[model samples]
Target: MDLILIRHPAVNIDAGICYGATDVPLLCDAAESARILGERLLALNVPPVKGGWHTSPLSRCRLLAEAIGHVHVDARLQELNFGSWEKRRWDGLDRALLDTWAADLDHSRAHGGESVAQLALRVSSWIDEISRDGRPVHAITHAGVIRVLTGQLLGVPRANVIQWPLDFGAIVWLRRVRGEWLLVRWNA
Candidate 1:
């Protein structure tokens, strides 16, 4: 089974804002971004609309998914909930709270948002459910969701998963072979 996770295009929000699960709009034209991404996927021998296509409900992802073609919208694919911090500039957030969360990435919910462990649980469950069918899948989701899924699939250390920086419109490929998940390509 193969899974291709594509992060949405750059959002319209400011660079330093924390907008996870905020349903923000795209900064780039969705159609153009999809076209470029489609070409790249084709070059890699990955069909742009292949198999069970899915997208996060947020417009940043959903708009691209619609531009690409048919896709099932799922809330499970949404980014980590940032709670009160949504739309707030990261630099303006309380430094002490940020440090506390950074100190315990897995357990801390310092922003009053979902903890790293909680996000991992939901993403892992989605992975499990989808992998059961042994079908190829393309998902238009967020960076946080992609990070959690990658960490769960690759057995990445919880604290270090954030280091795997993914740019807007990045694509990650994974495969499940003989009941084991393996990373095929990342940030493509």
Candidate 2:
């Protein structure tokens, strides 16, 4: 089985603004992104996307998904919920609270949002829900969701997973062999 995880295209939001659950619009509309991305994906030496075409319900992801093909919008594929911090600038957020949240990587809801554990559970369920056929499982989702799913597949520690830089519109590829998932490519 192959899984292809693509981060949604860039958004129009300002830098440092905290947004996850909030539905942020893309800098380029879905069709435009798809037009550009289609060429890019075709150039890459990755497997052709087959089977499920899944995406987060956020327009940033859904739009791109729709442009490419039929889409399955699943809330579980959404970015981590920022709760009350939905649109606040990161610099404007409370420092102590940020530290408090950072202190507990597993369970803290600091900055008022879903815990990492909750995200793991949500992403895990999505993983379980997908078909495991040999075809690539394509999904357009948030960086947080992709990170969690990658961590789960590769057994990367939760705390370390967050440190991996994932760029907007990046593509991560993983393949399963002998019932084990291995990283084929990252941030492509």
Best by lDDT: 2
Question: Could you tell me the lDDT of residue 134 within candidate 2?
Answer: 61
Could you tell me the lDDT of residue 70 within candidate 1? Answer: 88
TM per candidate: 0.95, 0.96
Candidate 2 lDDT by residue in tens digits, 1-188: 88889999999999999998999889987888888878877888767766547999999999899999988889999998978888999999889988998899679998668998999999999888784446678999999999988999999997888889999999998889888999988998
* lDDT for residue 77 in candidate 2, whole number 0-100: 95
Could you list the CA RMSD of all candidates, in the order they appear? 1.3, 1.2
Q: Which residue ranges in model 2 land beyond 4 Å of their true spot?
A: none
Q: Write the per-residue lDDT of candidate 1 for residues 19-90, one digit (tens) a residue.
A: 997888899899999899889898888644555478999999999999988888888898998888899999
Those runs of model 1 whose alpha carbons end farther than 4 Å from true positions after fitting are 47-51
The 10-residue segment with the lowest total lDDT in model 2: 128-137
